[model samples]
Target: MPLLHKIAGVVVVCAVVLGLTLPAHRRGAEKESPAGRVGNSSSAAPAAKVSGSPAPSGSPTASATPLKPIPAAAPGAAAVKANELGQIPVLMYHRIVPKPEMSLDRSTKELYDELTRLAKGGYVPITAAEFVSGWINVPAGKHPVVLTFDDSTPGHFALDAAGRPKADTAVAIIQRVAAENPGFRPVATFYLNKELFGMADAQAAAGLRWLVQNGFELGNHTVTHPDLSGMSEDGVHKEIGGMEDRIVQLAGRHTTTFAYPFGAVPRKGKWARKDGSRYSFQGIFLAGWRPSVSPFADEFDRWNIDRVRSEGKIKENDCTKYCSTAWLEYLDKNPDERYTSDGDPNTVTFPKTAEDRLAKEYRRRARTY
Candidate 1:
């Protein structure tokens, strides 16, 4: 009787082990993991030596997907309103260079420090897509930031010899910062003009794919980087629509944001328009001298969104006119007006005195502390 019981137990155990192991192996084969596909993104793009990079390429895939909207608990609460209300600063940068002759041109070290400062200050980088869709749902007490690079310079992106992104570019710095900081995310928006990464066609295409696959974002800065104030209606359409087409061709997705060139748009409502030929963008970013209001603020408008230029006071130049320093200083002077996270992302919290000024959408889920 004992021998028969032992034999039956062994057979049962063997069947259980096979059931557990076979499904895991099958699951592994079902989908292409991020680790395997990310490495080969630069293989199609030939290496080019550029001043900005080892330096240049092209956009969004990452393991930690962006916070999608939660279903609304109240009637009339749109999905976007499900996002907690908080202040978000979208920083605009250009030329992540090794050496900086101009104040606008930031060195890699400076970029690293800025990212570090944000991470240490309880800030998380959100993509431009997240900003536009109003899906920013970062953990409680963490502020959302958007690091946007205009001009698609070589220093913004570059690939190493082994078909991997170089670690010193802005993209690499963002990713590296996220790796070191537990809750920080590596994401930024790159606004493209021609010759992104100094690669013409094929390499540029590859670079764009890499950016998209790695969870970074791409936006339209126009094909020729023209000032829209001087252009006619048809010209404005061409400047934006054309770039959108090329970016889609490379990334296999629609680019939903547009940044104005030289901080200028042709008309008030004219910043965003789609002819029969193209997809209309949801966000239009302005060149800002200050941080923007909350995406859900009563004053906030998607088409006329603002982005603070990334520049600290370098040498003798005061960059506050076009940089974010001005707004930071203002907040320092009047801290009460500044939006601060109260460490609970599930429910929106702000000052009781500030309640009357909040957007209608925010008031629903809001709790004033």
Candidate 2:
């Protein structure tokens, strides 16, 4: 070979060797949006996927994997007759007291018994955030239920001497029931007020952090639990935004969901969903009598989600038909009407007959068997 050709060949070989041996350049991290600040929409809307790790103080920390179409065999859908478009019971509780003193109060034993029944019936607990995000990741043949506690009462959460959950509290009872029943998730969403579970500032902070660390979600229930329907837009914003700031200060996690104080949306309904970006609730719940439609259902409204009261079949309390007891029994009798998981989070599976009931946006994730 000529000297020039030999030099060219050696240069080519050196370039190839360098390309093979050099380490790949690291890609810069993508800038993420502030967590839990999903768009405010009346209808069910697509929320940005949140990062899993906790953000800094006064910021939000949550995670949700956006669903995508995966055209795979859904064996569990047909065998379980899974109905992704069916009703989901987002049961609401106010006070888990030692004794039932009022219509809204549930005794400790009653709460435990109800949870036990839910566990036995193959119901898995998911947070309000997950429900509103349409992230129902339950196992096959399991039903997703949202166990939400409002008011952040002392009975809702507290710590014992050794930092364990105190006995007779809702947290302790839920943990106990979950331990007894295999696969029963102890997770729940506690909508907090300014009171912070009636604990001192330090204790409250510890309790709030513990709940979040242990898979529980903290939500906004306004600074003062007021009848929002009668409040002005400014008043509503103050209450909601004030609560959001307080939650971030105390829990260090932004709230992803909100529950109306008295199930009352403002005269202008949009105020319930947002307040100038101080807080943006992906899901806003009402104190409802019946179970709500699936998040992916055509009629589902993220801003006006329904939540059933925690009561038995008592005519005096006017819960004979629509309360949790009657509703749970009704679902048991009519299993096909309840939301059953297809065991795949990425795909939303339902019967062919219910195909039309699904939201059009979710068609990509829809799997009809």
Candidate 3:
């Protein structure tokens, strides 16, 4: 059997044992609630210690060095307050496809059922901004869920093998759920990269416009989706600025949020160029750089906000299987942990093994509790 299958089997066995051993009330608490309750204050301390490098304080032009003993706050508190009553989780998704071969991606039916389940569970969907701004404060007993789609693939908007928007089934389910329950208005964020527009057969350009018109927010995922750390100042500007330009032209809106491709900085610093170099020119123009590893400072970078990537199979019946409410709860209780990359921002290091990837996942999930 494959590693994921083995891991899945282990999870199943563990879940069964956990279910049987846990107290009845606790078991009920663990019974895959509609959504994990987000606490108003994060119990976990800041992940990284801000260095005392005497860097310019609070200036966009400050050096990009990690600070030590950084002021620790509740997890995600700087970006958005923890849901005091309980919060709606912002789930991240990359692609949705029908073919079984694309296990990494989800099918339309699966996506539809997932939304239907959220609706049935009384989970309200909110936008990423709403989650960050701490607005739309949901009271206790009210469940909220945020849906995000990354990579802006054409398959998301078009039919598969047939002639339909690939995400039509899922979108329909979301729209239906939203319409049926006024309080359950579901919102999704699309992190688009301009390069992906013409790669596929479908007219993705037009589809993006359609998504925005229909009430979805278009977010920036950088122009070419390259690691920004190693790139010179100029390179960063082009990567970010270029995409912002395209998003405005296509979606008729300027994007404030960005998703880091591969989710880490480079190590070798090949992408880094001198401040005056042509490549450096782009970086100089960019509003700022957001490093995912530095959750403390990164959250303050409104233009380059950090996000936790949701991985594994996302089924309507088992949305929490990969990232359960229990796990998120655990993260909420322990906030010092943050996601990190192989090297500094310029030169990046990719995960070398399944263990490495799992470790990364474990760390990312640790914050949600």
Candidate 4:
């Protein structure tokens, strides 16, 4: 109990605190593909205006805030046989109308039923950004599903007078289904174009802000939904960057994902995922017919993720083979081929026989049991 002993204790405590405050550098962070950068002849578009009547009072500007990190898996046997190297169904929808008009459209009832089925089947929704970022966090024994709505149609989202989502819209349906079924995360990514859900200038802003404020995601679908396959690289950049700037202006946040208009990529496909002055897309999606490969799988392609149409066995659109209903049934019968999580995000778990199927970059965190 000497004065010198007290001074030594204080110094040791200070040193420990300083060490804990220092940043820990991470090793082997994923590197962007060395794809050729596309030229951006277009300047950043003017900031969008979100002010108007019926705006949510004191809405916070959408800034880049990190999502709540999921805690590590608790100690116990994993509820499901983990297969981090399996396929994931990224369901795609266009219009959700009271009555289906186009082959790609689904009625409100159909949408509800499909979502109910997914919930009952042990699937949890995640944003397209999260899926492409390999941040699939769901409870153990649950499969991650990405529900993407393209074209930003009026049937997707709307705000009622009381700032509630319209009852029959996709947003409301999702929220209702989630309420009825516990553990069903009511989140999805809506890719937007110039139409902005066919709303007036100011009302559109309120809707966009609402989506971001809630758990939904805003993604780039171009200023105009044109088939990029016919456009030059500069045109592609303009389309992508223009939408990115508009999203930042309206939502006050940048979009991490981009869905190709009509799923048509430019002649130079690499430009779809390249970083420009106004935009940097982490993942680019395609209007594919089947489910996407797990983001951690060796065959996964971040720039060209696939999505199954939200339809049943129908010959009208040739979706009989690879639509949502068919794919979900297939997964049900062949559960081992689906991506079942191990609850822990830090470690990748799969069957020992599937070890070679995992991407080499993830081997350091791999666990085969």
**lDDT of predicted model 2:** 0.86
Q: Which run of 10 residues does model 4 get worst, by summed lDDT? A: 38-47
lDDT of 1 by residue, 141-229 (tens): 45678889999988899777787888788888887888899899888889998767687788888889988888888888889998888
List ranges where model 4 is wrong by over 4 Å: 1-79
**Best of the two (1, 4) by TM-score:** 4
Q: Report how far off residue 282 is in candidate 4 (Å).
A: 0.5
> What is model 2's C-alpha RMSD?
15.7
Cα-based TM-score, every candidate = 0.71, 0.81, 0.49, 0.79
User: Order the candidates by lDDT, highest first — what do you get?
Assistant: 2, 4, 1, 3
Backbone clashes in model 4, listed as residue pairs? 62-252
Worst lDDT run of 10 residues, candidate 1, spans 46-55
TM-score of 4: 0.79
In terms of lDDT, the best-performing candidate is 2
Runs with alpha carbons beyond 4 Å of true place in candidate 3: 1-88, 137-140, 158-170, 179-182, 195-206, 265-369
lDDT (10s digit) by residue, model 4, range 288-337 = 99899888876687878899999989885676778999999999999999
Residue 50 displacement (Å), model 4 = 45
True-structure lDDT of candidate 3: 0.47
Writing each residue's lDDT as its tens digit, candidate 2 over 264-285 gives 8799878778777698778899
Pitting candidate 2 against candidate 4, the one with the higher lDDT is 2
Worst 10 residues of 3 by lDDT: 281-290
Q: What is the lDDT of residue 338 in candidate 2?
A: 95
- Model 4's number of clashes is 1
